[model samples]
Target: MNYTLDFGPVVAGLPDLLRGCAGTLFLAVVGMAIALVIGVVGVVLRESPVRPLRWAVIAFVELIRNTPFLVQIYFVFFALPLIGIRLAPTPTAIIALGLNGGAYAIEIIRGGVQSIHKGQVEAGFALGLHKRDVFRFVVLRPALRAVYPSLTGQFVMLTLTTSIASAIAAYELTSVAKLIENESFRSFEVYGTITVLYFLMSWLMMRAFGLVSRRYFSYPVR
Candidate 1:
């Protein structure tokens, strides 16, 4: 009952924390971009005619989805150096985040792609669209529209996962918070403030996604 809260350290570290927020956003955005690319490409290859290519994508998805992300980040940061593939902490964190997010993205987007009706693809072809055009316009667009909410929700989770990158000394909010807490011994205040910041960041991300959904995925008005 004698404990009192002090926010002096948290207030002093606000500038650094704001910078860390930027770093977190940077990592999340880049990682999500990479994951989206991987999801799309993996889905294509997952449905490829070549059995080996399909198997490879399946193995990747299962391996990542089944493993711990901490281990994955450790492998990327520590093990890769053994193969002469060293990367800086930031790059390592980005790669780890991308791969982790991408595995789940592959499954999420595959579900979306599968939700498209075969008849719509056939109609696109009947309209003289090329195979690629049919897939892009008739299949991919509508499928993405259908799954946009799920995909964005996954991306938000991926954003939160950036906290794990701190284990590797990546320059993000959690890493910065750790430093502040170590120096100030104000774990409660530091963590509590950063917790609010994280919630706000997630809320902001959802709002941004809402704007995108309204703009790009909304059904056409009559």
Candidate 2:
């Protein structure tokens, strides 16, 4: 009951923390972009007629989904160097986040694709659309629209997961906060401030996503 609160350190470190927020957003945005690519490509392969290809995608999803992300990052950072694939901490973190998010994204996107009626796909073909056009216009776009909420939710989670990258010395909010806490011994203040900052970042991301949904995914008005 004798502890005194101090926020001087937190206030002094505000600039660094703000930069860290930018780092966190950079990781999240780049990671989500990679995840989207993987999700779309994986879903295509998952639904392919080639049993081996489908099984390969299935195995990848299961492997990533079943494993711990910490271990995955460790493997990438440690094991890859053994094979002459050395990467810096930031790049390693980005790749790990993308793979983790992509695994879940594959399942989410697949559910959306499954919800599309088979007749719709046929109708696209009937309209003389090329195979690629049919898949893109009739299938992918609607599937994405149907699942945009889930996908964005996963991205938000992925943004939070960026904190885990701190374990590997990746330059994000939590990592910066850790340095501040170590230097200032202000665990409560440092972590408390970062917590609020994280909440704001997540809120901003949701708002941006809402604007995108309205502009791109909303159905045409009658």
lDDT of each: 0.95, 0.97
Q: Give candidate 1's TM-score.
A: 0.99
lDDT of 1 by residue, 14-41 (tens): 9999999999999999999999999999
Clash totals for all candidate models: 0, 0
Clashing pairs in 1: none
- The regions of model 2 sitting more than 4 angstroms off are none
The alpha-carbon lDDT assigned to residue 162 of candidate 1 equals: 97
lDDT of 2 by residue, 115-209 (tens): 99999999999999999999899999999999999999999999999999999999999999999999999998999999999999999999999
Against the true structure, what is each candidate's TM-score?
0.99, 0.99
